[model samples]
Target: MKERNILDILGNAEEDTMEFLTEKCPEITDAELDALIDATEKKYKTKKKAKDGTEKDNNINMTENEVSGVEHSRRPAWLAPLLTAASIVLTAGVVLGSVMLLNRHGHNGGGIEQPAVTATTTSVTAAVSTIATSAGTATGTAAMSTATTQTVTAAETTAETTVYTTVPFVAPAAEKLYVDNELGSIALELFKKDDEVRYYPMGGGIECDIHDGIKFAADPELDIWCIDYSVEGDSYPAVHDIAYYCHVTDSKFSSLEEIKNYARRTMSENRYEQFFGGKMAKDIDNLEYMDTIDKEHTKFWIEYRGKLYELAYVGGWGKLPSVFSDFYPVIIADKTDTSYTAYIPLWYIQVEDINNCICVELKLILDPEFNDWRVDNVEQFDGKHYEELYNMLKG
Candidate 1:
């Protein structure tokens, strides 16, 4: 049978409202219909009782209302009752539809809110479907079930089995850093959120593996993360640069001073000062507390400008000098509550010609000693892996 337009019927005659509803949802028994009507009427009375006197005053002084006179004149006295019935029916449809949608999304483990209608038996499936269709929610069988009881049970099960949580991790940021030197043009950046930081090696341009390498090390006792980098000889032709990571725990000395202290403690003070070109201080700022530490961290790099003097001529054109740069930022590919992945793109320019980029990917875990991140795994991939890495970060 062709469906009757419920709104048009409501406007045409209030007497046909029950007949219209029965034809639309024949599964609704007389007892259920009576219960729905009684519930809706009680709710309407409660709302009416809670209202202020202003609405009553406006009803008496209708002339002061902002609505046009013609519209107000056409409103039927029985329209309120028809609207109340329609609202009740629509609310029931919404409840059922929401349960179906949640079930489809694998959230069917918890009990869903039942419709206001109190069915005597579990066979109100057809009635629920018809009402849902009337309220524009019965789109397809994928979400809607023939058995309303089954659908409700599935949703309830989902609620019982699923646990939702918020995991703490730093999300990557939008800021970028660009490097265009004798090496090549490249972009890199880092993101900071709260106490965590994430890095992006390829920021402004297409995501590619270009920076030589990015190394991350956490301070033993602090939240500080020290970054080290290695640039290939292909970048500058004669130099394969690298900078070792460093961290300072003592506030008395700078990062440089901490490095110097390590060198002094590792070797004889005179030998260390001769290589570093500085005298050891008398204060014993950091070395007194430490027994042994890596002296390489104390190494520093300088630009060394001007012409090459005759007596200071340096030789060996066969192998490039594997020296460290001043500093390079680290890239964060992915992050989690206790772990993260960082990346460094490795690309070199030979005679001003650009080459395909490769990347070093590092997986890091939180070390219990200092609550610091430690490298757990490392992998290398070409630009072809960019899509996969990008998806990993997004996922």
Candidate 2:
């Protein structure tokens, strides 16, 4: 590239004057030169403000060069100083414009075209306006940046909340039923037949042989249904019986508080506080006890009658395992909009006589109060003396 002399292009100016201007100013590109010429013309020509603040065109044409071929007798007295000031102003403008361009586009330039100032200004103004609105700040760019971050965080949180709220409630699968004891989440194997569902905690549903099963005696006054089974002899007139005294009723509970109250009201005796671990009784009367009791497991209690000749209470009973509680691993056997059938394990008796889990089948109706279900009926199965039936000789 050749360095073009400024005096060669401005032959009408004095040689010393041209040399001074070129030495003090940087080499302007064609685009910058055109901008400088236009700015100078606009400032000194076509409009001038009068002392009375009225505008009128001065008709002053300041950029006539040697290329125009318009010769003057002599230059005006103020022309030299005016041209000196214009050259200095143009040099400053060029330097400022280049810095702005490099800051925006970067220093790596092969032949990058400079962006128009008006277009850049408009874009920047619009962006600043948007930031100012969001940040509630008229002029602080730092506030705008902070506000943008907060807005994005809020949007993400709302999206997560929306997804959580939109997801429908799904009942856990039968295999997923678990009891959270000292050891966390002990899985229960589910065995269901019709409405009768059982969860094997010891996983011996197949090994436990039911010689006789499902003899039911109902006490309607107490809303109690007693189911007895025997593994030693027959289900009816059994030698050793495993009895489950289930207190079943058509009851509506608006909340768990009501259910707790019902549990307190319907106990065989006034041992609800002791059994549920509220305020302990002053006397040491031990019908049944728990090692640990909390809201998760102490919601209800089941009386497991170990020895019973008939529906008459022989008084041999204790608190069933916490795994059998209604607040424990209850399997939703069947569910619908208006009603559902829940299979709650009442007791698991594994003794010398019998090894079986007594599960009660309950049909619950939906109530409108708290969208909770109430016990509609307790479905009872009749006694089956399998061992006695098998022992009959062939005729």
**Candidate lDDT values, in order:** 0.28, 0.26
Compute the lDDT for candidate 1. 0.28
- Candidate 2's displacement at residue 5, Å, is 99
Candidate 1 TM-score to native: 0.18
Model 1, position 246: C-alpha lDDT score: 16
lDDT by residue for model 1 over 1-395, one digit each (tens)?
12233234445645344332222221222222333444445555554543433344345334555543322233344555655755665565454333333333332111111122211111123133221111111111101111112233555445432110111122344232222331121112211110010000000101112232222221222211111112233211111021221121123334344444434332233323333332111222233212222222212211112110000000000101111122332345345577655654433211111123334444555555446444343333443343334444445
Give me the displacement of residue 14 in model 1, in angstroms.
99
Model 2, span 1-395: residue lDDT tens: 12222223344456543332232221222222333444544444322222112211323334656332234334445555665655655554454344333333322111111111110010011011110012111111110000000112455545542111122223334443332331111112211221111110001111111222223222222222111222132222211122221122213332334434544332212222322233111211223322222222211122223311112111111111222433334445345577554444433211111112233344555555435444344332111111111122111
RMSD of model 1, in Å? 32.8
Cα TM-score per model: 0.18, 0.17
For candidate 2, give the lDDT. 0.26
List the RMSD of every prediction in angstroms: 32.8, 41.1
In the predicted model 2, the residue pairs found to clash are none
The lDDT leader among the candidates is 1
